[model samples]
Target chain A: MNGTPEGTPERTVRVVIVDDHAIFRSGLKADLDARIDVVGEAGTVDQAIAVIAEARPEVVLLDVHLPGGLGGGGREVISGSATLLGSTSFLALSVSDAAEDVVAVIRAGARGYVTKTISGAEISDAVMRVADGDAVFSPRLAGFVLDAFGTAPADIADDELDRLSARELEVMRLIARGYSYKEVAKELFISIKTVETHVSAVLRKLQLSSRHELTKWAAERRLL
Target chain B: MTTALQRPPLVRSSDRMIAGVCAGLADHLGWPVKYVRLGMVLASFAGGAGVAFYAWLWTMVPTADESARRNARRPASPIAPAVSLPAPVVREAPRGPLPLGPLPDGGAPPFAVPAPAVAAWFRTRRIQYGKEILLGAGLLLVAAILIARQFGVDVPLGTLIPAAAILGGAAIAWMQLDETRRAGLVDKTKADQAGGWVRLAAGLALVVAGVLVMVSGSGSWEQTWLALLASVAVLGGVALVLLPWGLKFWKDLETERAGRVRETERAEIAAHLHDSVLQTLALIQRRAGSEQDVVRLARAQERELRIWLYRDAAKDAGLLADRIKAAAAEVEDTHGHAVDVVTVGDAAMTERHEALVQAAREAMLNAARHGGGTVSVYLESSDAGSEIFIKDRGPGFDPDAVPEDRLGVRESIIGRMKRHGGTAVIASSPDGTEVRLGLKAADTAEARIGEEKP
Candidate 1:
């Protein structure tokens, strides 16, 4: 993929790695492909917010448990930069697979969640996916997001599910059930790029984290 | 016969049904207590003399306190009588003192009293019983005077009765005035410490009797003044006896208070050790790397110490699951294998729970050592019992092919569950291996019953 076609110049994905462990950040930075640029790094919530704001990276890899900033952890970094949320997306890279950790980061507006054990290539691909406005998740963590938000809508407030447009709801259920952007697009008889726009709108309406969490949310509610 | 000179026989206060008088007499005379008691009861039918004699013995016999004091003073004596007497003698020696040969007196009695020993014994007994004898004589004299008056003989009842009262009170006061004697009496009847009212009443009775005597006396005022002085002397002696007892009681209270404070401080130190030392050990167990085996050994020690410390804390099932997860994590870290632990339901960590955990841990180790990449542990519990499953995706082995000497499977896992009234089932094919350990509540009850029967 890095061997771009004969004439066009390659565009690198601008990324910021935020993690508490220095060794993990450095190792990840070293392992990432040349097509991805690690523009900045931060170990704490405040530092992450500051670096993300200053670097204006297209993708921020966040750790769920960071040292500072109102004790909000990774969620603080996301909420602290609300204005940047429109232009900059987040992909959470954490060592924890705990259901609450996954749900918290997702609800705080991370576009995906993956464990530290994932290979560097997978992490790079995940970064590109999040930068392209697509949700990514490690296969195991998808179940947690589904279980948390996928409960029957009868138990949820009517307005919570009712706020979505019919088309957005269809997109949500499909995306939440572990469907990729291309798969959701084919299923809905829509263009692949249009599917991304609908997913972004569905995520905004439902206040969810990523497509993996969306699959969990839809599966838990038995919507798919 | 034991000589009184060796060590005066003391009333066994702890062995007493009522003042230990019979037991003491039996001890001194080397007679069975039942026989001595029977003799006293039979003698009591002869004009009530036995009751008075028993009371006299109760009053004069040196109590345990006096015996201890005597023992303390004569350290050179081989037999410290009080120290030699076993505290549990009353329970063990219910048959009473050993019987000797027939007595020379008349009937073939249970005890034989040597002639010289009896004479020497009486000689010493007379001195101890002297005040009681005097009081008895004084009572007889007053009775004789009253009888004389009843028969119309000219006898001054008031003067004679008051004189008897004064003599009896003086005798009691004289016997109890010595500090050692007072301590002996106080220790024997601990109730006397609260008997101030009784003492006051006795003093008031003596003064009333003396006042009557003074009113009826034909003698001069000097004789009446002498009787009043005697009454005052009796009251003063009673006060002297009570003073030392009160001091001893106060000192004992102070000692007890100090002991309680020291106990509280020790308990506080124990609580501190529980929190700090155990917590540090737990942290080391989690963080230690290449020292994983040492950490596990320390963790086991910590668990035992915790069990000993908080013995009454109920072991929750959640904690059992947590322990299993921790064990799996250790194996994962040490061997570079991935283990996923999942738990369902909650219960108390009973013996069955512990057995399941141990078996599961063994299974996990087996999987990590011989099986594929990722191992999964599942723990589920219900009201019936708990179940644990350890699965690995490694190439499976035939159960029959296992070496006879390999105790990891045979003893650690299978034998453990069997002992706990549980079952361990292992399934291995070329694809993977899975071990399931199951414990049932009914089986636990049966195992307990089986244990009790044997």
Candidate 2:
């Protein structure tokens, strides 16, 4: 129930292979098995869901259109099938990479989407990424995704204080040293009450939080 | 896909709001319109918001009559924009109306037309479309700018300008295609017109916002962020929305251009054919006694014609120099000695003009050869009609004097003159022979507009 240590390699990534086309599934299974031990290979979504429940593969290679796999006599959009795959990281395998197709799948909970025309190596990489909880998408689709959802800034610099006086730094260090209002007053030869005022001034100048946090931060950075 | 769309719905295929009409129609057709309408409604509503739409319906129950419900299940054909024509269909291999046999002779026709069908198709429609595109683009530009202005917005135009320009140019281009399409100028398609406006709108909005974000002291660059997002959004949106249409437009343009080129080549081939190969075939047909003989002789003769037809002629021989000079001189001086002409060595053998000159010179020679002569030559490049002639005072003979191996009668007199796009005629026989050669001059740049129709 507890979290593993940083960089711990304790968990095995399970995978489920699903495709309506038998030959494709068989071949995909052989490849996945040889590369990264698949939990189960299901020829259809029905079998795959059953296998997924039984084996609990972390990844499922979800086909876009699964014939008769929707438990109905008709065909549905690839998105409908995606929603049925549950929380298992769904890596979409399809022959279509149309902008609409890519967006539809991603919007349908597919962790990764790649065209079937891709080489075995690329497919393997895509599968691995999806299994590892990373979103894999084609370049255009990725752009579309970023376009639809506002993009986040990659770098955020901390605010700078350009005009703080040099005496402010000494006052900030002393304040960060965990000295009491009275102790700092004696150490710096300032009035005890004057020390409290300097501490307040230091907080405002350096944009630091309360004195307790400042002490811990100063101790970590060797600023005291 | 086209065929699938043709299928009629259970309802009136008029609207898509409810299941009543679909249900009634389904009952009539022994099918479930309710389920069908449900599926269709689900599919249609799922386009952008399926869940939210259903939830809204669940809360806001409408009080409508049963008959109105019947109306809702029908498809709304009028609301949907007409499907843009499919991308130019890639024609399968074989070209031309029919394999009218191999490339014909007498060199290719000089005035070959470019895609006549495409030209003819776009001739009337292009101008109308181009104007629409222009109007739409202009309106969209004004609207977008005014809206942005109204909102107190500004944006950098550097990036957006290019996109708008691209659209504007495409719109204006409909007007320019007349040269390729023959008499008809630009015809913008619906897709083209829409795309142009959309482009202008997107560029204007995004650019204005982007500039505002940069200049004004906005709280957190949200305007610039949105502007950038808007620009990208417009690009993606327009591309996704108009890709098939734009592609179809481009393909049509390309095909039209291609059609023009192909048509030109075909015309050239036809002209060459009519001038030589066709004439030659006609001769063989008349001469050959039996079908078998015609077939056998045609194989050899056709091969022979195709063979010598492609010889290397000199690049820069002064073709028709004598004719041009003689004709130019003829316009001024009327009563000159019957134009006496001479041909020096192989002058500009490869020049197409040389062919006309050769024909003219041959006409001159034939006049002297047949009946010594009073000949006159006249030519005009700008003033319109171009002519060449030969006249001499000699024992003027009649047409009856055409002897066998008569180069003048067979090749020069008839074939040569016709091949030059002119005719050779005997003007008078009053103590002198006068031979005249005249050809119609092309008013504009000599062009061919022909396209093969399947």
Candidate 3:
């Protein structure tokens, strides 16, 4: 979005698509090939695999739980081909992001995963993310990953928090670590009243009753 | 402590070692610990039956100390926390004088649950899923290769690689009928055993069908006795077997989830022991540590593990809230959150239905994520009807969000939903978002309920 214009003529994103529905594949390819970057397309995993292995496209766009059947050999193709997921990069374009399908493909190490109903730009962006070595996952998938991982009750608001001034949290940590007002003031080269004010505000916001309890809660939350 | 109060028996654990209730009695009375143990073991041996007594003691007595709650976050002592590794335990310095409960009168409890059990389950799940995908893909590849050759599209794998590819795709898809065994992975409330039986039955049928097709070479199994035999034993037994045994995997998940249940979380102490101090102890046990050190460390870990488990118990009490969320989604058009409201009656289950469900879910998710809207859905209550609506308030652009991105108003909203006898409505406003779904439901009451509910 920065250097690239809205239609910046950069290297076209090469893509190989697969779907069991031939007409569906044709329609999809027409959309992609029309964009000046679609290298090849196939209607089944085999054709996609062969095309991907041969053409080595920048992105191997996939459709989950394809129209065809699945079992031992079908699973093997997905897993074996999974090696290319993080490298040559496989992007799942699926209709179902059911926890089973989403988690299954993710554990196999897909570079990017989105449903087929996604917009062309999102699909294009997924391809770009895969091309750029960044992992891409739909929003629903983000929750799936967190659920599957069973993340301990930790703050998952990292991106939002990153934008805020770290200085504020740091000041709160110093107070929680038992540095009294004057001491905190001395450490930060600020007035004792400023330290007192900050401590007062921190306690109020975190909703702790006293300084002692504040430190305890902060310690347990690893906020200190 | 008096003998009666001191000598509570061990709860159900393993055999061989008693809860040492007798030992507690001896220690309290300033007598040899072995005397009490021998008396009980002998008591059982004489007539009560030693093993039965052992089991009973395991059931009756607080294994370590019924009151000595191990922390759910860690192991018994400061001993090995991780399970795979062996680390020595160490006696921890007491925090302060305390009454009993999580705190020990003499010392913290000295027990730890093995760790590998929990981690290994997820790891096993991952491996199994990989196996399934690899198998599925391989089948497709072989078929696609055969089809290519059959159609003379090239790739000389012999006759009909092209036709075989098409059939293989069918065979591969037909094979997925077995993976249905994985449905309850996220939901614990489902009566899984019954489902497991059904899944096993279904899987076996699928496997038999697959094998019959592979080996029987296009024979009508209904007309042939050999096909029937193969279907029942080879295909049915094998596919059915994975479901029953795979049931352990399901139970393990339940055990993990129980940490969130009040009744079940009484056992969360075990997992806490595993995750924290147990994990730490496992690390310490292998390294050189004195017996006294291991004992002390184990005591510390037990307390820590106890604190963690109690805290986890508190947190797990609300785990039902998640299921509540899932249920709510079923009635509403929630995109970011999960909700599925579908009427799956045999003949009605068609490719179009699947495509519609998939498309709606995808678009709704996108609108919620990018278009900046709250996803709300209502399945129209009519004959086999469903109505879904997704609305967003983001800058309602004239053009679609993306081209290859697919879930545009076309493929995602109209095309797929339309196939399922459903309609997808995408309407965005400057104020906010909304999508209305009109779907055919066998029981309009179900769809009407979604609409009428708050």
> Best-fitting candidate, measured by lDDT?
1
Candidate 3 has a TM-score of: 0.28
Model 3, B1-454: lDDT tens digits are: 1232333222222232445545544443445667656655654444333433233223223334322443242333211121111101112211122221111121111112233533443464454334323433453354445456568876643333333434434543443443333332453335644655554555544444444555655556565567667556765678787987789998987787875686556567576557786676675677436654554455345434434432433334322222222333432333333222221111233355455456656655665556552333322222343333344435654335546565466776677677666776665445444555555554557768999988
Candidate 2 achieves a global lDDT of 0.45
lDDT of each: 0.63, 0.45, 0.45
Please list, in the order the candidates appear, how each scores on TM-score for chain B only: 0.35, 0.24, 0.24
What is the alpha-carbon lDDT of model 1 when measured against the actual structure?
0.63
Give stretches of model 3 more than 4 Å off: A1-8, A30-36, A67-75, A82-87, A153-224, B1-454
Interface RMSD of each: 11.9, 41.4, 19.7
The local lDDT score (0 to 100) that residue B151 gets in candidate 1 is 93
Question: Per-residue lDDT tens digits of candidate 1, residues A96-204?
Answer: 5455566677778988777776567668777777877776644334334223434233333445542455665455444433344555576699986676676555445
Q: Residue A175 error for model 2, in Å?
A: 48
Candidate 1: segments with Cα more than 4 A from true spot: A1-14, A33-37, A53-58, A83-89, A94-103, A111-224, B1-318, B329-345, B380-454
Of the two candidates 1 and 2, the one with more favorable TM-score, higher being better, is 1
RMSD per candidate (Å) reads 16.9, 42.7, 34.6
Provide the lDDT at B434 for model 2.
Answer: 54
